[model samples]
Target: MEWKTTSALSNQAIRTVGRIVEGSHDITIFSNTRAHPLSAQVAGIDIGRRTLTLRVFCPAGNIGDYLSDGLVSFDLEKINRDDPPLLLCFEKVQATCERIHSSLFEVRCTLADTLLITIKPGGVRVPFVLGMSASVSLDVYTGLTISARLCNLSVGGCMLEVPLEDSMPLTIHQQLPNIYIQFPNGEGLRSKGSIRNMRPFGRARHVAVGIRFIDLDRDMRQRLLYFITESEAELARRMGMENRRAGISPLFLVSPHDKKPANSNKRRNKLPPMAHAIKEVARQQHIILHCLKNERPFPEDMLYDSADTLLHLAESDRHQFLYALRYLSEEAAWVRHSVRVAALLGDVLPTQPGLVDDAREAVAGILLHAMGKPLLLSEHLPSLDTHLTASQRNLLKHHVEALRRQLHKVGWSPGPVLNRIVGDINERLDGSGYPAGKRAEALSELVRTASIIKIVDTLTHARNGRPALSPLDAYRWVYGNDGYDKKCLTRYVRRYGLYPVGSLVKYTGGFLAWVMELDREGSPRQVRVVKNLAFQDSKLDTVLADQDIQQIGKLEEVVDPANFQL
Candidate 1:
């Protein structure tokens, strides 16, 4: 084959190559003949080295034969059909190939020449905001399953937002043998396709993969068309409403100088330190929980990273950790509960001299242990006041196995110690717990500690319709229970006191205060009064000694923070 050569690429061609590399779009590489062209995707482009790295697909296992001569030819075509044909081309360019897996090869070649080409665009894609989820399985040989969200849909193809960690092994044009999409309304669509493009999305936390459906039957195409039409109409309706609300018109425009600066400090001032920390932690946990619920692989890296953050917060200020729990939102209830349990464990476990290593595993395990509960039950678990049927109870019990199977599917071994902690958290000493009903003798120390913390948090928090127990009452409930380890309970009480650091309490004089500091014996040493006798907003910091408590009034009662909108 003969090709035209150029000393340099035009600015337009340079921009096109950059887009191709960033988008990981497919390109064609020819070895000796155009008929034997190898399809490849741009992995990277090195402007300094003038080299292009391509991940070439070789289903026939003949890439070595094609690249034996260490030379190849390829072309970069125009991104849009309206543009001039052929952006760049190369002939007999020096190249090398290395096998990545069974049918994938990474090929690097130097850029040499230029040509021009044209391309056509695809059908209109309807983006979704309804939180549709997808399960994608690669070819049977790879046995890799990817959990993704539908970004947009069309008759011929769709775009998927895959978790960035899960997209690491995927290459452009890689065959996805199976894709199952589940809509919020219980509708499901199945198809087979190959990836056409991949690019970073949403702060580089996820990758958007463009997939072209192959051989859709009439019924599937009709359904897809119907969905797209409905989605488009809905989108148009929303846009129209927003425009009307803003009184949008070509005749009316706002001057930049007339606009007021945003009050960025307003929110910061309104939210308390505990509330701010809860919001930050909630944002991180949302991603982790989303992955788990979608049956995606356990994000161990993200889990540990979040664990470190939670542990640091717990260690640096036990008050902040406990106080943050009071601000948990009803959204992502599982995540909220798990995080609370983890934070509590982070504070309590470190004080033990011998259990330092176990503390890390225990905190991480607590964060993810109830992962299957959200999938099995509602996002907000039924309150203790709600009576569950035997079937429902059984279903809840099965979450342990559900979580274990999810981990197994991704071939994730959370190590024996962490595994044991996650697996045995719900087990009881009296053989009352489900999923093997292991007795106290079989449970490890870490598991025992985890069980105690889980119960304490569960009881201390208000759920769907149940009232939250005061910290003292919650501790008393656990102390009365036979399933928990007494030694762990003793240590827990000693560390947190009858009224924990974050406990809201009413004094004899009708003053409402939050416990801020506790002495070695677990007595409150300092308190922040937030309400006066009239129940009005007030702030008064006071240091308390044993004599002060007797002189004023003892803490009349431990109150629920939620009751005061704390």
Candidate 2:
């Protein structure tokens, strides 16, 4: 087929195509006859070579015969439906093919003869020179939080303007733990980013740091696009009004606007009730950790507030809290673990007489108990399976002292109740624990309860190189141990069943599911089947009732939740 072609592609066109290819958009490959069109997806792109690698969905044997003439045609379509319609058609493009698997073929094609038309604008950076405040942490361990102003923003990344003093310690390509931007509505957006470039700003009074956002979720991307579209419309309207008032003919009569998707009005993606709670608690814990690492005094009231929130969540719906722990992001294991322990403590502590008054303080202490570990260990943080040298073990023990010093530096005291819980939570009944190494009587009831909760969480969750023990195994380990108080351990076991909520277990017939609820006897009552008997992920989350379990067979064993990304 004869086709129009461009000698060179513009930067905008290149960016648009890059996004489409990276997004893995489906494209149709056609030969001379449109009757036998082969469906394909863009797998990879080589910008320098101007070539595209496609995973074509066709019989491997048929692909060789289909591309025998070494020519194919396809179209690169726009990624967003909201964007103006745009299509870049490649006509009779030179091609080659190879078998990837049974029904998949790998096709490589060079865009030698291409027709580029109706190119949608991409990577349009809108200036946000207004007072858009942002906090960027250069390193998670160092806790170096730098204040910056939003200079310009786009869907991919943004440029921040920081004072020269604040930019002194930054390096190019340094991964930032988080970039928190406070929007006009007082909501904050947290993202992981890396420094791409740095240069002096106007007058050299400030530095312009370019950051590329990494792994932005769909919700974040939509928010950014909405902001950019609104800003562009505002700019156009302002310019048009200015020109009309000055009695000068407008350069362009019509203003540009985005045709947003129907659901674009929705601010954020709807997460499950439990997932939303877990996310909020995790976000708060992250901020608290950041403060502790930086040696800054966070709002003291926030501790009690968050503790109360956890307590309420645990009391009202302990099962949901337990199940939601699996949804936490994998960035900060310590923080996630702390939240789990604290929530568990909240659920278990209320049963003890006279302990309800101290439950809030106990939960707060559990949350911040390990806040100092990241400051000291940094990259050397040890896991349960890590074989630590004597010196490393001793260093790890000093994290308690480190936390005390940190609290003292901030001119805050957690009070006597919180102090005991934080300081002696690691101490065991048999004097085997570290720091103080208090014996049975020396460790208070509160300390004993929190300690059991912490150990149970540590053993049940996978970390570093260690495979997680089953809930029953973790409980057994603690119950069989000497340091734990039997009463507290029994309470814990009663609260969380042998196969607790969030436990990934394999039943008879090779079916894998997550324990969702338990009966009075702590036996699994409800489960959500994630994987079928063939070990393939189930398209639908099929929740099985107690009766359904009998037909599926007995509960075989608890598998590591990490393996299934539960």
Candidate 3:
């Protein structure tokens, strides 16, 4: 994304331009030295036989942060190395490759697409100095319509060089709400700001409105920052200004402080509930699904690399997990399942420091163990649950083996302990499991540990139009006369207590609570109330941030979503 400026040249001259010589008006030195647009400093410019070579450098030689991807052939019809044209425009050249050559100097009209700015009329451009015009639509809070221009462009919000008459009251500032900078195609850029300083040109019937971006929503902020850093370098290239100083410090938009309610103390006491967290998870999961559906990929590490992250998610820190989950899309269903599975396992695992690391890894593995579903489903329908039909079930039976094969393909060996876990996730100690009919004695600890994940997965979805198996019912089904290894079941109950963490359930009193931590009594005895189902008086009720569970009771009344207040 390098941009250079070309000087005024006549249509009938071919002169070889060279670097500026110090202290003398002498010109005849031929050097292809170029300057940076962010900070005008002479840099090595190599004009390749067929390409424009640009070499950007850091003062400390750390070129790691700079990247550009806007380069094309220099216009061939405009100029030639052997017969250089008199009038030429030297604009910033942007591309990934590292070459600029004499052969590429010819001017091509189509080259306008790669160039960021053009001084000529009707040319789309980025600012060289602190001035540029951005076409924008402004909606005044008073239902007034006005066309606004983003001028006086800087790293912060640009000045809305508005065409307002001096007769307009200066107090117009007080009535202004937040203004949105609409993009070219009517999409709003994240550059939302407020009027910071205003100077009215009454005689000219215009106002130089200074706007300071209060809350930049990521993308627009980055664009402004990039432009700021590149502006000075661009100026140097255009004027052939050789006297360069250190680059100007880039500016940033300051975000406004969020307004909080007057009763701050009560709000501080109310943490976001598990349901809120789960809602975030759902939202984030949908995002991931959307991204995948659009064929976009997120960082692989975010998908299934860390188990401690999952454990922390189940440990009353729903905010972090929810943030993480928003980056995932529904297409990454395996990753979604893995996160929930690991979160559930985190609840049941021993919290002892010595075993925590191992437990986290185990949970991570189980959640992602069936990650081959997407691939499997492409050739054969995916059966992620126990309720698949006979044909679908047969097709789904190959996932464990497929997972092992994929692991090997990627050259990852999580050690034999993990290997054993994957090998027996589908195994039942009663010799009725798929792919393996191993008996109780043959089932290793790793297998039993992996089996807990199966139990949780089964129990979580058992009632959502899939089936209605409670944790207790699930336990009985897995350990009863028709169940698998009783010893494994007993170990699970003893290890994780009765109700696992991350579990959402209702009590006898009709209150709903998510299992937070196992009570000393076991069986998910202690929980956090997510919503007060009985509190129907909106006047008495406050926002979630100003809520008080004690006003109702120790437990929450859980109702169907159709009947829930929120």
> Model 1: which residue pairs collide?
85-116, 85-117, 86-115, 86-116, 86-117, 89-114
lDDT of 3 at 497: 47
lDDT of each: 0.63, 0.65, 0.42
Off by over 4 Å in 2: 1-270, 329-331, 377-393, 533-538
Model 3 stretches with alpha carbons more than 4 Å out: 1-305, 311-336, 344-361, 379-388, 463-465, 481-483, 494-501, 505-511, 515-518, 523-566
Worst lDDT 10-window in candidate 2:
243-252
Is 1 or 2 the stronger prediction by lDDT? 2
Return the lDDT, model 1, position 347: 81
Candidate 3 per-residue lDDT over residues 121-173, each given as its tens digit? 43233432222123455544343434655543555555555543211222223
Worst 10 residues of 3 by lDDT: 26-35
My TM-score estimates for the predictions, one after another, are 0.55, 0.56, 0.43
Best by TM-score: 2
| Residue 103 displacement in candidate 2 (angstroms) | 64
